[model samples]
Target: MTISFSELDFLKPELGAEFTGDGVHFAVFSAHAEQVDLCLFSPDGKEETARMPLPKREGDIWSGYVAGLRPGTVYGYRAHGPYDPSAGHRFNPNKLLLDPYAKQVMGELAWDDALYGYRIGAAEEDMSFDERDSAPFMVKGVVQDPNFDWDGDLAIRRPWTDTIIYEAHVRGMTMLHPDVPENLRGTFLGMCSDPIIDHLTKLGITAVEVLPIQYFPDDRYLLEKGLRNYWGYQTLGFFAPQPRFMAGDRITEFKTMVKRFHAAGIEVIMDVVYNHTAEGSERGPTLSFRGLDNLSYYRLSPDDKRHSYDTTGTGNTLNVAHPMVLRMVLDSLRYWVGVMHVDGFRFDLASTLGRTRHVEFDRDGGFFDAIRQDPVLAGVKLIAEPWDVGDGGYQVGGFPHPFREWNDKYRDDVRRYWKGDEGMIACVSQRLTGSAVQFNHSDRGATTSINLLSAHDGFTLADTVSYDGKHNEANGEDNQDGHSANHSHNMGWEGPTDDDGINTARARRRRNMMATLLLSQGVPMILGGDELANSQGGNNNAYCQDNEIGWTDWSGRDDPFVDFCGRMIAFRKQHGCLRPERFLNGDNEGPREIAWFGEDGAPMDEEAWGQAGRRMVVLYLAKVGTNGDTGKILDQLLIVFNAGGECELRLPAVNGAQAWTRVLDTGAQAPFEPVAAEETVKVPGECVLAFQSAS
Candidate 1:
């Protein structure tokens, strides 16, 4: 099946190296390159086999076919052009670049001065060009076979009302899992193993929002300190999965994991970082995008094109405003959804993506409009971090319809209220109702708010009540890195204490917060390992800790707390009133579907809501309305929250309800039976209780 070089086809439309049975077709986008050469390497990816210049150029793409090249061919690209940094065109023929559309990347990026386009000690810095070859230090792209046996696997598009996201790291999830095999641990195969799937199913998780699996490089500074980027936020190649996460050098391992998850009725949601790349500012290495078309790929400074317009706080931000760059991002997304079988994506630093060419955030930006109209992407779940470190970038509830945003407001206000902060009752109420003040417009539903208590960037749920201040000295940042205003309380002691009373208080606090997250009128996202009471030893920012501090400690899990979380999830699923499709309000409508009450068993007045010292509040949810005649009425639920000292609260009486069964009590940690509607129950401090009406 070998063909000669004269039989090469120069009209291939697809980018990257695609195998076509008899040979491989190479196509790349480099708008500024004077010449693009396809550099081929040996089977071991060490020695250069051949360097052939692409024979054809149509628009910005350079394409050519290499006869007799097989699926396992190792290749890279070298663009020869001007190295003028001031005008933002950095093209170095010595530095081999990775294909932006590469599906399979091989080898680790060895940090060396040779990888950079400039000399390390040059006084001119990035402005001076170096003639050293970057092939030995750079990573190479491998031609991949895109065929996979899906085995009748389709997407599990669970509705937003029923989706419970579990944010997990592909490696940190199963790294310390006892049941996982040694060889499979910290890999894609281990994440969807039998034990992991069983645990998620029992916990009632519908989707797993996995952290970045895209190909990224380890930071030189972190590696110098003997640490690694445990959280893969720095993306190098969007189309390629992280090579380390695969047990073997095969892209099909990720598909296998997805197939297994689908078999268990679980959806895979990737946390994608498209706002920036691993290549830093102008001084950074000439990696894939930086060397290809610097001016076209990055948002360079309007004043000085040598510098980057960094809205992501990362050194460089992707210039998605450009048509070609936008196409690349959209293409990467479609490739993931169409070929990888992933069900959703949580865009990291999404505000950067929503920014217009003028550097201001726009809800109707090109990125949003393009994805909203995309046929393949519109059906998949889209979640956004909703903000970046740029100016006016904190867009918590500012996203459009069908796009859910991570609600940091919910996390902070919930933490403050549970920590006994004054004047938080009002703020907590807004969060409980899905932050209606923020996201109630534009026909958006209550589930637009992705409610979360703790995530990967901050302290774990167990540490939230165990550490009053961040302990991030291990991050090599001198304890000055993570947020100082944590809005956290250490109960009576800091860190892990030997006292039983403090441990009990911490456990109760975790339960209260977890219950609040699940019972609220929004989509709940449980930080993975929170159910087992996982801790990072008070280190809120363990982004560089690849050791035990980052991995989930399965052996030291609290079995009782795990059971409590599982029960809470199951309870949330059983009751549809908790996750309402529409926002609940008391406008004196027909039958009054929802009502708020104070501790006195009466309707909450304006004075009660404005109380600075009020910590006890009641929520009454009923399905009664015009639909009652159609037999669509559901059982009513009464939820009570007591964040202050122990107090007695009289239960509110509802129509056609005789007895109320206490299904959940977060404080007592024990079983409870039914109580009458008129009975006054004593609620423990920092507790959450939910009662179901039995007619």
Candidate 2:
């Protein structure tokens, strides 16, 4: 019962296809377009039935009202304008464009030459416009009913101090899971499956920071190489949850997953990419933004309008300076939080969002100001990648209050100290104490630093100890891609080895690093398969590896390590001294706790701090309250880490405690043992030992 374009109304201001009781209102912003046409297709999306030219234009937005347009309608847009790439107006009406605000897309982008704006192999390049109709090859927008019954489900709102972020890929987390059903595997529903929920519950994880689940297209080059984007970093739609990841109804299925996680008291934090789109570079396709208004959508070079200012290293950067673009970003974020019910977001390359008119990252930028002030985002957690390729983009300590920045210093120093580097003692000391130098400022607490050992962008924990350099030959770049400055020590071997001694040392080092991460004061994040000892065959950057190389191999492997990791996480949660909200202090300003000790059982002096080659130290933490109240003092714990040879450590004398009890020994083949602590305890090389006071 669709009506013709002759009687359509044009009075709406809200963007996207907003469904009222009897009609759907549509609006899109395109400042440089001569005209905009709404293309409505059949249910199958094979034939276009109506091409309704927008009759109203108000402040760069052309909108109209379609009567009797129901929820399952398939549609797209076509902007008719100049074909001049030099001026950045690359509008090609023949190439149907995707709606940037589409909540549910109908199809996938089929890789073909017709999808491009220019002639495929012409010498004129982007200057040569191709008249081929690209509607057949492009993805179309689906009118989605974004309604769901939460039935009293609400945000978990776990405090930052209690959160344990388990970063995982949505598909890779359960694609090969033995317990997950075959039909539900590799989908959003898989995350709520019994096996996955049971594993997360046992591990004591409070929040699962999932990798990018936004609508993304498989890169054409990756397709040619017979690989795909396993990481989903290259997003094509900000508002749409990728349909491939959905099992049935897009909106309802995602809401069900979120409800189940909420039922288990686990929050879902999404890793999002608002930096760039799939339509890349000057020679790339003329998709939504490019075809609609390229000049307003992308930041072009000041020297040349034909080129884009790509600080993200992703061909183009979204122009947030423009008000319309900023509004779109804001709306998209709100939709995810309000409509979709996600708890938080981890912004990839967040420094780019703060870049200003002077081409510098401003802490007081519009994006940050808008987000912190937004009523909906006030309670949501915000984590930043903290650094980008732009100038002065390494903002580890530069973020404002309440936003946690990923601390790369912690990653490097902890790895170096456990690897037994020559000059790592001082650096590791700061890292072990929640990286106070980088995060402790302007009322920002220690939890402002998100400490992580390995993430999806880098090697898994297994490969970190088994490979000295990145092995990315399978990425089809002749192994020239990925970071080369991996401060990794392979324990005298590259990749996997049959030598038992080397494997033992590697396992011990992993335990040592894991112990240091949990004992640190900042919020800790664990890469998904690190607990299961998942290996990528030494592939550090497997962004393009969608096969077994990127999937989590959940077959028969080391189960003891997984148990040990769970125990460690539980221990950290139980102990308050390990995760104080305030930094270590001596007065009422904060919690006066945590002291470093030498092997001789004395306070760490200047010489001990300066001992660059020293790889052994004892950590004594006062199990006291953060208020510095002297009335309620709990038992103190002593943690010893030995990266060198086995040393007999003399126990430290507490204020009012006598004998100690050994709780964990990573060096032993059977870890997590209990022993009556004597005056002196022998700690094995490349091992971690924990002891608690006995009254």
Candidate 3:
């Protein structure tokens, strides 16, 4: 595969492994490299076959056209340059680099001390450069052809208004399922099987917001601790699909999953972590970007270039302010949407991506501007985990249009109110109606809020009511790693209870929260196992626990919970008022809209609306009529919240309606069964009631 830099097409700056008829053209960005060698490995990825130098450097890119190289050709790079850590140039030719644009990787990195650029036992720490070869322990980028029939596959493009997200791990979702086949069980095809599809459809989820399926490294620390990084947040390669998720052919298998999901009318929203790489601080391994160009790829500290200025709380933060680095991220996103046929993205630590050169987060930064302007990305759903672990990182309400942010405010307020926190009515009211206080700006509609009770990083829905404190003991961090401000409350007894009364209370509380989430006015994201009453025994932070602790159990133990979720989801879809377009300004001009009421069955005054510690309230919704006019003529709903204690609700008369029908009663023995909404309905304490005006 070796050729003279002058003889072949070697200087083309398109960064990636590109298969041209016969040979594959490889390119990488390393502005600081004096020389870069293209190290080709054997098909088995066991040994290095040849080392060819790319003498031609166009701008920051080093590229070469290998003559006989074809698809599945494993390769890495050794960029030759200065080894000064203080200067932020930690280039050691011995360390192999993965192509930033690698469509697929051939092997998994085997953790070893030899993989470090510095000697393991050296006193110089990172200052010492080891001459040992890291090629044997490194993973090589596979030269994937990127040509799939696709079978006319296209983006599902389900609007955010119509979308209900289900956050799930590719492995954990179907890993322990008795229905999914034994061999296919934790793979991509396994999740795409009939059983999973039926479950999602029944749950009324329009999109599967899967946990990171990108190529990631199982960290050395987690491995030593006898745990695995199950969440896959620490990304190793942004472009490649995780090889572990594939059963047979990687590209085809992934495409098949997406295609099958599309066939089921379900959109796939990939949870991508572009904010940081798996490579940690100065002490971490010289994997990909760190080996390519450390200073150019990572945000090094201004005072000390040897240390990284991390914002994502991951050991290193990507230097997206750099144009080429920014381009790499933009290119990776496009590849996922265009090539992979993914409908959208749920960006982990997304605030890190929107960081500007001035060390502050800006909505109109390069990362955002690129996506907004790109034709491919503009149409897809863009969700942000909106905050990072840096200064000015809590930007929950600051994202621009079309970027739905993860609304932590909604989660906290909802949890606090249901857990019997005083003075939560004001905040809870805002959250119930899409948090208009946070998102009512710049034409940002209700869909701007991606509301959730729980996600992968925190407690699942079931655990929230079962544990008052985080139990992350399995992570080997002394049970001190997860969030302390959980806003959770155990119902009488803590963990599992034998008392029928306590279990009944916990079950009702779960229903209360689920009903609140589904009936709320925003894009509701359900944690995968939540609908089935899944719990991790109070382990809020199970990021490193890849075993049954993190996997969802599908023993149908919570068939009642599942049925309730299905009915509620259907009820949400049947009504238009739940997912309104504009903020309810009390003008109620259109068809589907809202009107607030007090316990006295009268219009809520300013004092009543803002009153704290008020546990009971009434909300009236006027759904748009079927005649298709501006008038709100057709449907009407009366939602009641009684969190304080058991009380009788005198149903409000909406437009002189005679009777109301109970669509959902969280306190009832059979929550989903149709019950006639009486004039005075008795709602139990810590319960939520949904009623529609009977025609």
Candidate 4:
């Protein structure tokens, strides 16, 4: 039931294919195009039925309306202009382009020479043009019906102080899940299945920071090596959810996942890659952006004008400095929040997004200012992977207010301290207090640091204690892909070993790391599958391992460690002093809300902190008065972290409290017995012990 354009009708300025009950309005932005043709494909996308040139040009937007068009109409675009690469205009009508604002991208991209603008393997390289019809190979956009039965679902805007982010991969989380239906596995629906929801709820996770699920393609190079891109960081389309993650054609599957997560009181935070696109470089294929307006879409080299200004390490950095490109990014974010109903975003390579035209990372840049002032975006949680592979891009605490950053310092220092590194006690103390030296400015609270021991980019918690180095030979990169200095220590053995002592030591180290993450005065982010003690067989960089190597193996799970992590998360939630609303600065004139002590139970002086070999510290936290109450201790907690040999730690006396109840010990199993306050407690090496004040 599709009809071609009867006559050229005025299309609205709204980007993408907008179904208007009677017709579909197609619009796209191309600053320097001689002609823009709207190619309508068959329902099966096997044939291009009509190729009508957009009859209207409103500024940079080319648009037209086709009457009697339905929501499922498949389409693509072809911009005709100069094919001069040296001049930075790679326009080839032969290569069909995907809509940047496409809500649903249909068909798998068939990687062939026909998909490229220039002749492949030619002597002239990109200078020679190819007129092959790429419509037969390109993925087309679908006019999706935006209506969905939300069923009264609302965003769970959990405050930063209460947020416990569980970083997960949509497919990795449920691909091999025993409970998810076989047909639903690796899809959006599977990620929000009852079993997965129950697991997250039980683990006390407030939000699931899902890895990039936006429309991305399998790298041609990886496919050649019989591997696939499992991380989904190479985003192709910002507005379209990955077709691989959908069980069916409907884009509503993503919405359904969000709805279900909201029902379980868990927020959905998307890991977005807006800094770059899958289109590699000037030598890359002429995809949507390059074909439409190469100069306008990409930051080309100021000197060469042909090569891209690559700051993201991924060939080309998106020209977000351009108003049209910036608008597209902002619009995409708003669509995710308003239409898709996602609660937050974790911007991948966020430092690149803050780069201005001069290519320097600006804290108050256009991207940050736009998002901070945006009413819709300002309310949502914004987490930044605050560093890029560019110069001056390591902006850990450089983001403005209302934005939290991934604190790698916290990760490195915590791992080093627990790995028995000398001179790490001082840095570990700073990390435990939320790295106040880094994030204390601009009135930002302690929760501004998203503390993590491990993430998708590095070794899993289990592997961190088992592998001394990265085992990425499987990634086809000669074992030199991942980080060289992982700050990891193998407990007397590399990789999995049969020795019971090594296994026991690895278990204790895992517990200690998890305990430190929960006890820190910042938002804790548990790398998904760490609770189950999941291991990648020491493959720190599994970005290309789509098989069992990357998937979370639920079969060989560490049940005891799972229980320990869950209980630790519960303990963190129950105590307010561990995750305070403000920095735990003890310099105030009033009673101290936090204090660091040595094993002798005396307040740690400057001399004690300067000890290079010391690896044990006692953290005393007072629940500061809130809601207009006087700044006084409402409740208190004492946590002991021992990274060295076994020692007796003397307990501290509270103001009015008589005894302290030992609630948690990473060295022992749950159901801990209460101990007297006046007695000395034995803390083993690499163990964490928490005690609550009791009357």
Which candidate should be chosen as best, given lDDT against the real structure? 4
After best superposition, candidate 2 residue 30: deviation in angstroms? 1.5
Query: Which rank order by lDDT, best down to worst?
Result: 4, 1, 3, 2
Candidate 3: C-alpha lDDT: 0.85
On residues 541-617, what C-alpha lDDT tens digit does candidate 3 reach at each position?
Answer: 88898889999988745988888888888988898778787776566444435777766667778888677768877
Q: Rate the local accuracy (lDDT) of all candidates.
A: 0.88, 0.85, 0.85, 0.90
- Candidate 4 is scored at a TM of 0.98
Candidate with more favorable, higher TM-score: 2 or 4: 4
What's the TM for model 2? Answer: 0.96
- Looking at model 4, report the run of 10 residues with the lowest lDDT sum: 669-678
lDDT (10s digit) by residue, model 1, range 1-695: 32234444457778888888877888899888999988888877898888878888899998888777788888899998899899999999999999999898899999999889999899988888899999998899999888899989999889999999999999999999999999999999999999999999998999999999999999998999999988989999999999999999999999999999999999999999999999988889987998899999999999999999999987999999998889999999999999999999999999999886558899989999999999999999999999999998999888887899999899999999999999888899889988999999999998999999999989899989999999998899899888887788899998988999999888889889989998888999999999999999989888899889999999989998888888888888888778788887677535556788887788899999899999889988876534446434465888988899888887777555556778778866372334444468777777888888865
Residue 303 local lDDT, model 4:
92
For candidate 4, write residues 1-695 as lDDT tens digits. Answer: 55556575575767999998887988999999999999989999989998889888889999888888889999999999998788899999998999999999998888898978889899878888998998888888999888899988888888899999999999999998999999999999999999999999998999999999999988888888999989998888999999999999888999999999998999999999999999988888877999999999999998987888998998999999999999999999999999999999999999999996568999988999999999999999999999999999999999999999999999999999999999888899899999999999999998999999999999999999999998999998899788999999898889988999999999989999999999999999999999999999999999999899999999988998888888888888888888788897677667578888888878899999999989899988988685687766777888998999999888876445457888878887553556555567788777888888886
- Regions of model 1 farther than 4 Å from truth: 1-10, 624-632, 655-658, 671-678
TM-score of each: 0.98, 0.96, 0.97, 0.98
**Could you tell which candidate, 1 or 2, scores higher by TM-score?**
1
Predicted candidate 4, C-alpha RMSD:
1.4
lDDT tens digits, residues 1-695, model 2? 55554354457666887777676778899999999999999987889888878778898988888778888888999999998888877889998988889888877889888888899899978878989988888888888776788898888889898989999988888999989998888889997888999999898899999999888999899898899878888887888888778877565777788889989989999999987888888778877898889999988888888888887988988888788888898899899999989999999998988885557998888888888899998789999999888888889989887688888889888887887788777788788778888888889997888999999987888888999999999998999998887678898999888999999888888888887888788999999999988999888899998778898989945688888899899888878778778787633333336777899988889988888778888887776742575545554678887888978888988655578998888877666778898998888777888888786
Off by over 4 Å in 3: 1-6, 10-13, 588-592, 625-628, 656-658
